[model samples]
Target: MYYQCFFFLQIDRQFLRISTVPLLSTFFAELDRYSPRLMEIFSRKGRQAGKEITQIMDAISKDDTIHTRRACVIKSLCTYLNEDPEKLVKAYLDSDFELQSTMEQTVMGVYVILIEGALPDDDPADIAVLIEGVEVLSDLNSIAQACALLFGLIYCLNLSYPQQLKCT
Candidate 1:
């Protein structure tokens, strides 16, 4: 599903832009504009990247299909934001970031959904979500891993939840 979204197999074929830029730089750029908003949401649920276990619990609690799709949609929204970071911040007052809130929280919400329960188990599908959301991930390998996880999540969960239908 995620693969089809970004790199459609049979529809409008396009490539997912892999930023040659460093991951930390990309994360900081968004953080600069939306840190407070991101923090508020992150803190609301006590999200801590360091706390792997809690994060898994959070992901599991979220609506699985919603979480997966949101995580994937975030890629589309985030890529736009990445290309024109200044615009989304200065313009788009009804910003998707504002409407959707920070990029991180929404991604985390997706992560939570993939986990689908507080209890821990070694599930490849669950691990994929976490792989996709790793913030410091900068290299192509990491980005590829992220994409792979997203694809697996979406492919596995598509029937339960369809992608957001924004247009007619």
Candidate 2:
């Protein structure tokens, strides 16, 4: 799934502006904009959710380089969610199912962040609904999902790339 996203991004570099940037940069950028909104929703849940939000916010806001910040946040979130970062990262890198559960959570977490940021004026409670809204997208496979996600992200952020979409 990760590689599907990677290759999809690679193929749509003009649309995604991801050709020369690390994936983490895009994640961090989106998180920077949307984590606060997530925190707002989670905080209403109770003390535990508030604490979880704090941990995620801390990881996102840490004053470090992009790569380090991503690692920290991924590590912190995985740990808080009761998964081993070492194992998950390894499995994620290896494209294996060992980290499938954790990876799914992480992907959902990211999508939530993206959705929240995308619809800033909407209620955060609608995240699940928003996700469901995209369920009818064609080609329900990893590459297709990645392509749809990238396009959704571009639409959400109103991003403009220097290059034009072109076939190789």
Candidate 3:
């Protein structure tokens, strides 16, 4: 539904071990995607995207692996959800002229659609469907698949790996 992300950066170890409640509440479901404080704690590790982030993603199986594409998709999905209602996609395109000038990857970001904040329904199963599509998607679909997979990881897998994600 409503989407917002809490970014934690460059943290040292002393604060990393504190109770993870504040970190977990961020996600509407399965809230821990490497808590912000963890990042503050583990900045020493540098940015190890996939493995580092994955280490705390969940112990269960990963449905897809699109670590490299997350940032772009997050931007796109954010843009999509925030679009003006009357015009729909066309208006979104018109209003986002800057998007046309963006790099191809940026313009075509993928993300899982989470519904909240006065939306019709916020079913986690819908998020599950997004996850299932990941492995089978093609190029264009990959971005969407990746986003959906992330939603599944956060919603379905209830673990916190704030120490896992790395920006660099």
User: Model 3, range 39-140, lDDT digits (tens) per residue?
Assistant: 334333334443343343331133323332232233322333333211111111223445323323221223223233423222221211112223222122
- Give the TM-score comparing model 3 with the true structure, all chains together: 0.19
Over 4 Å off, model 3: 1-29, 32-37, 46-98, 103-168
Ranked candidates (TM-score, high to low):
2, 1, 3
Q: What is the C-alpha lDDT of each candidate?
A: 0.30, 0.37, 0.29
Superposed by TM-score, candidate 2 places the C-alpha of residue 138 at a distance from the truth, in angstroms, of 28
Q: Model 1 over residues 93-115: C-alpha lDDT tens digits?
A: 22233432333333321222122
Candidate 2's residue-wise lDDT over 1-168, tens digit each? Answer: 211222334434544454444453464567556544644554454465446545644633544344334434444444445454433232122233443354434321122212223332222221110121232122222221333344445444465521322110
* Model 1 stretches with alpha carbons more than 4 Å out: 1-13, 16-36, 45-168
For every candidate, C-alpha RMSD to the true structure in Å: 15.8, 15.2, 17.7
What TM-score do all the candidates reach, one by one?
Answer: 0.20, 0.27, 0.19
Alpha-carbon lDDT of model 2: 0.37
